[model samples]
Target: MNTVDEAPRTRRGGRGSRRELRSAIDTTMLPALKRKLPLVEPMDAAQIEQIDRASMDILEDVGVIFRDPQAIADWKSVGADVRDDDRVHLDRGLVRELIKSIPESFTYHARNPANNLPFGNDYSIFVPMTGAPYLRDLEDRRRGPTLDDLASFHKLSHMLPAIHSSAHHIVEPMDHVVAHRHLRITYSSMKHSDKTFMGMTTSPKNAEDVMDMCAILFGDEFMETHAVVTGNCNGNSPLVWDETMLGALRAFCRRNQPILCSPFVLGGANTPASTAASVAQLNAEALSALAYTQVVRKGCPAIYGHYLSTVSMRSGAPMAGTPEISLMNFMIGQMARYYGVPWRTSNTLGGAKTFDAQAGYESASTMMAVLMAGANYVWHSAGWNEAGMHCSMAKFVVDAEQCAMGYRMAEGVKWGDFNEALAAVRDIGPGGHYLGHPHTQANFQEAFFMPELFDNNSIEQWIADGSQEITERALKHVNRLLASYEEPKLDDAVDEALCDYIARREREIPAVDALNNEH
Candidate 1:
């Protein structure tokens, strides 16, 4: 929690340094376009004012459904109108109070200072949620995720530079005790990277138990550096806050910890079978969370959590990383801005098959959409596919490169006081290329460029190089990176402390083998 710790030292020399090798295999990726794409563009100022007014009206009149009696009573004590034991009517006055308490931003510590990332208003960072897929291992080609697979995925995620944090126990690993010991396991992995947060279990009590363990790991100054015990909250239908979610919210507020209040609004499910309705649902859930923040502690630091997915009408399965999902993230980013909250959304994904066009197209499209939409922080930006059912280490490396490409795109055209560059452009005039200019050589790295994840080589060279497809290339790249990865150095004292914590927790929560055993 001490924000004053020294930053992590920068790593010396990696693949990133060899960015410009002019082979067709190395053509830099290019951003598709540069323009704001909004759900409702050019809504007049009056219309904008109307939406805000109407939203407030809904907060007060239509009210939000609160499934927790305690949250309702708490709101009632604060003078909010209570409709029932569970639903609380929140008005603009209450909303404003909550918004005031939330902080503009909060910092997440890195073991090494360089890895630390600040989340709030002006800064955004992305960390992927790993697990759920590999229903069968590709090696044994087994079905469902096993403990070893999950741990491997965790380590793979640990190596990503762009993915700033890793969600512990991505799926139910074999070490079920460690499942609850996520704080310790996460802290261990976190020794390698600075920003570590957790995916609090659906059960609020379980979430709290894990957080209590983390608090010990962090000592007294916990909130300042850790990702905090931020849980996911999903609405059943028509988008309403449930008891489980409210409990987590109240706990965080009471403890003065930040909450990642995310609502997974499936397009065509729990929402008006339309993308716009899904957007409305997201906005409503966010506002409700914002209102809760003000009520708990006026202006308490809260993150804008928007998770979007689509249900296939035919298969009844959730489809993530679709273009529609990315669009959903983009619109949600705007909603986050409207409320002046920092946003957390996920990036596009590869697929059930790690190395293929399906993965490439999906990841690329989603990344471009979210970046342009101005999403500050992206979760699950790399790895996992087939509706979060599996993860690919190879894909993780490829996605890292993709994320870098998107970040480069986001950092577009920085114009400065240097009239020299513009004047030089004028001097070079029509038909004059900058390829030969001294300034061009000096600053091309600063300009737009792509990546070499695929074989940018000419057909002849590609054929000569074994006709390796993107997937094959990505696999090789991932293994090479993993081979060179060095385990992070942690103080012996801290490591032992974490070990004791996990052992104590295991004694408390015995493993249940027969529970929820579906593959």
Candidate 2:
């Protein structure tokens, strides 16, 4: 074979060029990772077909509950069987036909043009964890999170390179009332970070309010055309979609913005104990909601989403990093690909109360499965612990660095300066090493992936360095990130508009003392 050498993407250009490249890539928002490695297909064609058939049979026969009058009306309009006024039997053909209009790929627009996320076709977006009710402070004490804590998480997500989105509701603003919390969280996400952010889905009005603020920031016409924000609606698992979630779905769909139709699955508690059976049921629930998005607005963007966890047989506790979890990840990825829609999966999850070895192993396992399964939107990719009960500030930074390392691995190996490397090997004899070679000097900076948090020095050096453990080290990094954070630029008029809207809404929606049920 006669062929010339191929230059790697990061061409060797000596010191000045390498420094320039470093400057460009070190601080800026990392784009959606374009994976070069092949996806891990854990199932054969026949196995996938088995899942597909089971899902279709569930939808056509068992039916999914659409617990809203409008959702039932929409289903009837789409020729679905609505007998019980809530549960609708969807035809598999109809779902397949409606979802065909979904765009296979779409750009997730951000306030800064450079941060727009590219979705689908082996592109993965790493997002921070959301919906954590408690916060594990830098002192390793658990407490209810406040608005300031929420803003801090947004700033960290912005400073981190691998995190793609400034995910809203990183933790619940327990200081704020439930009725008005969404406004503050959404505003903090927009102001603290210029990256794409998720929208509030607590209620229909809350979702509309987020869109209104986005209209101010991105312009009404621009907001109409581009997906500047995203909203996530989780189906109450075991084939149920509540009115609150459906309301948010319609609100987002009407604006032509992308919405994630996810089913929150806890195996054996909310679903069957079997992994394949739960995957089939979750797939059917997700497909019904995905099809509903098209019914709300044809051609609107949608994602097949789910939260997968297995329950313990002893106490019914949800387990993380189980073999069944990875299996579901693979099967769901396969189904999403077959249906031509983007998909989402959880990452960096653990059931440990502390960031110990259990947390590390669990998070590592989930992260590996997420990347290998080709999840398009990786939620809970960082800061998740205690089975999502709390967001740890220490684990947050470590997880971000972990995401950066994972991203590098997902990029596949680079062959920069192969011929030069071969020449260096030849110059260094069998008895000699290449540490002092010219190629080594030129490429050492870009050669290996250097992790920032983990300590790798010798015991003597480690002792001299103050004998710091991982949690303490991670705490230091968290403070450093917060101090280094720079708030992104926003138009003054737009900021004023967002504040005005929040003020008006707060006045309209009163803060109640306590709640027994929905008012």
lDDT of 1 by residue, 64-146 (tens): 78777776776888788877566666777667656765666667654555555666654546666554535333232336555
How well does each candidate superpose onto the true structure, as a TM-score? 0.81, 0.93
Q: Which tens-of-lDDT digit does each residue in 1-519 have in candidate 2?
A: 111121122235656655554454355777899988888888799988898899999998999999999999989987999877798998989989999998889899998888988888789999999999999986788998889999999988988899998899999988777888889999999999999999999998899888888888887788667888889999998999999999999999998888999999999989898988999899999999999999999999988999989999998899999888998998899989988899989999999999999999999999998999999999999999999999999999899889988999999988868888989877997899888888899898888888878999999988887888888788866765664455787889889988998999899987765433323
Model 1: residues with Cα > 4 Å off, grouped in runs: 1-44, 131-143, 146-148, 171-188, 222-230, 320-327, 350-355, 415-450, 514-519
Query: Runs in model 2 with CA error above 4 Å?
Result: 1-25, 514-519
lDDT scores for all predictions? 0.61, 0.88
- Give candidate 2's whole-model lDDT: 0.88
Q: Report each candidate's C-alpha RMSD, comma-separated, in the order given.
A: 7.4, 7.8
**What lDDT score is found at residue 185 in candidate 1?**
46
